[model samples]
Target: MTQKSSVRQMIGFITDVTRWSLSGGIGYQLFLCLLVVFMMLGVFAYLVQWKLGLAVTHMSDIVSWGFYIANFTFLVGVAAAAVMLILPSYIFKDKDFHHVVIIGEVVAIGALVMSMTFVFVDLGRPLQGWHIIPIIGLFNWPSSLLTWDILVLNVYLVLNLSIPAYILYCHYNQVEPDPRKYRPFVFISIFWAFGIHLITAFLYEGLPARPFWNNPLMGPRFLASAFAAGPALITVLLVIIHNTTVFKIPKQTFNKLRLIIVISAIINLIMLFSEVFKEFYFPTHHSLSAEYLYFGLDGHNSLVPWIWTAISINIIGTLLLAFNPGKNKPMLLLPACILLFVGIWIEKGIGLIVPGLVPSPLGEVVSYAPSWVEISIALGILALGMFVVTMLLKPALIIEHRFKAEKPS
Candidate 1:
């Protein structure tokens, strides 16, 4: 536990985590290759889209939102989820998640990068995305949600990931951690985590013309689903890592995440039902967005199928997690998490994209299916996120293992 030994340990851990993310075992290497290959295809696809315009995808004026936006929204929810783990451990002093907190941060960083990338690609001219930068005259602080989104996304990303990294790093290295000296940094992270997704949800909800996005309840609903899925992902990941490595997730911590999954899952379901009731109770054209989701309306049958799928998966997933939790087998939990992940993906993807198309901006339906190019590019981003998480966690975990090993028996 001497300073030099601690520093060496810290360096080793950081290097390991870094290696796992970008370069690691054969599996990690293959993952990196997969990510690179997909991204290359995405770049090629984008070039084609730019050359021919976004028409390469099914995007039309009627269906302005598409694959990129759907992924962006869902990943924002994914990224925001890290807070559920971090807050409990740090603020609430819930030590159950102490082990998983750093991994949560790593996942947050990966997911956020993907979300931002989607925003980047979704732009008409990707390079001009810097138009939101203050030095540029294009920034309309008072008028543009784009400006706010730019500000919140970057700031929150840094805040959410940095503190846990700094703390875990210092602890691993046996350094003073001294984040206690920067308490405001931790405080800001909590609120910032919440804000990033709120702003993201607002990015959609703020749109007055798009009735689907206009629901005032959308922001909170975004948060509920995020918390539900975020920790569940971490739980599944913790298990996977345990299987692959000597490290074992503490039963206490695992149980904690199980509790979190259940609580957040129920809350998410309740919010969905609330929105549905409000929309269906009154039942008007303004409610057509939610209606279209539950049951097909007009001629747009594309999302009707997915909407029911999302509802069933989410409802079932939530119930299982809520009741069974620690009692269920890990394999059972895996499916639950998978189901939740799929359910959210469908909800965000369909809810954001196709609904915007229905009734259009001017009251018309449009046929909107993501073309192969769009699907490929979207999957490429996802594959990249998974690849990044796999890489980063491998190194970060080694650091943790060394620390735990060095601990007194």
Candidate 2:
């Protein structure tokens, strides 16, 4: 291997120390092992998806978009949330957020990886994954939103990963980061993060047949939900990192998290309400989708009940996190996190996919039931995400710890 490649691998190998610890530890090792086993299983199932076709999953002509697309979109939302920390720190000169910008970028990287992985799994003709390459392949450069998503997500990923990795390298090497050296790239990160999620939302909103997805507000709603879910995810991740190691987050960091959570949560909740009102006020055949969401337009339903519960849980969670920031005690924070995740997952995953399938534009009603294999595969992807986060962030955290000790904190 080239010397540069060797050095990168060595850095990665050092990062694997946490994997080694997780493999050896008594309590947490269980999760580590499970993450591995699940990932392997997921990979096997993906092979099945590739070998067979999309048939292994429950997708149909009516339900062209299923869990994978949903996962992709949700991950974009998760990835975009990192801007809460990254932009405010770099652009606004918030030194407090500077402390965790690396962490935030790493989280964005993790989410981006999962989002792209979902793209690989979602394609019907898996081998056609390469068709989008420009000079070497048949490029759908103009028409498809999938194409745009592919471009934006990947570009954003490189920018996000580069910024953090470069910063961390400076941290590890005990060298000053030439602020001038990275400023242009940092400016790009601010726009790239927004672009990634906006393109994802546009991918759906641009679709005309899917009235459920055809709202102008869909894009902003996505950003709002992303803002909420992303920060909440980061907060949980911060707490997890704190609890899992000797590291501790001070009150100041927690305060920033609380503020971001509140602002984002309020925006997200308001967006949901506006969505409901937009449907009710105009009351078109299009209104049926929102009706489907809130009050079950027809006898056709397994989602409305759970969706109502999800909305309730989401609203309550948002209220608790946003309004009662004082009660960020672990118990409150934990449930609030669970509720926000579930709510957004349902809204984006089930809510988006299922309703679009229902009372179809052609007036067909079809439902998707993912098989054991498919469900396993999806769980495996999530496990893979968790495993990757553990592997990538652990060594970085250790390095950060050493940096904090050596530098004037």
- Top candidate (TM-score): 2
What local lDDT score does residue 228 receive in model 1, on the 0 to 100 scale?
Answer: 83
Cα RMSD (angstroms) for every candidate in the order listed: 3.0, 3.0
Q: Compared with the true structure, what per-residue lDDT tens digits does model 2 show for residues 329-367?
A: 776786787788788878877787667766777877654
lDDT (CA) per prediction: 0.78, 0.78
Per-residue accuracy of model 1 over 225-310 as CA lDDT, tens digit each: 88888887887888887787777777787778878787877888888888788888888888776666667667767777888888
* Cα-based TM-score, every candidate: 0.91, 0.92
Kindly provide the TM-score of model 2 when superposed on the true structure, using C-alpha atoms: 0.92
Clashes of each: 6, 0
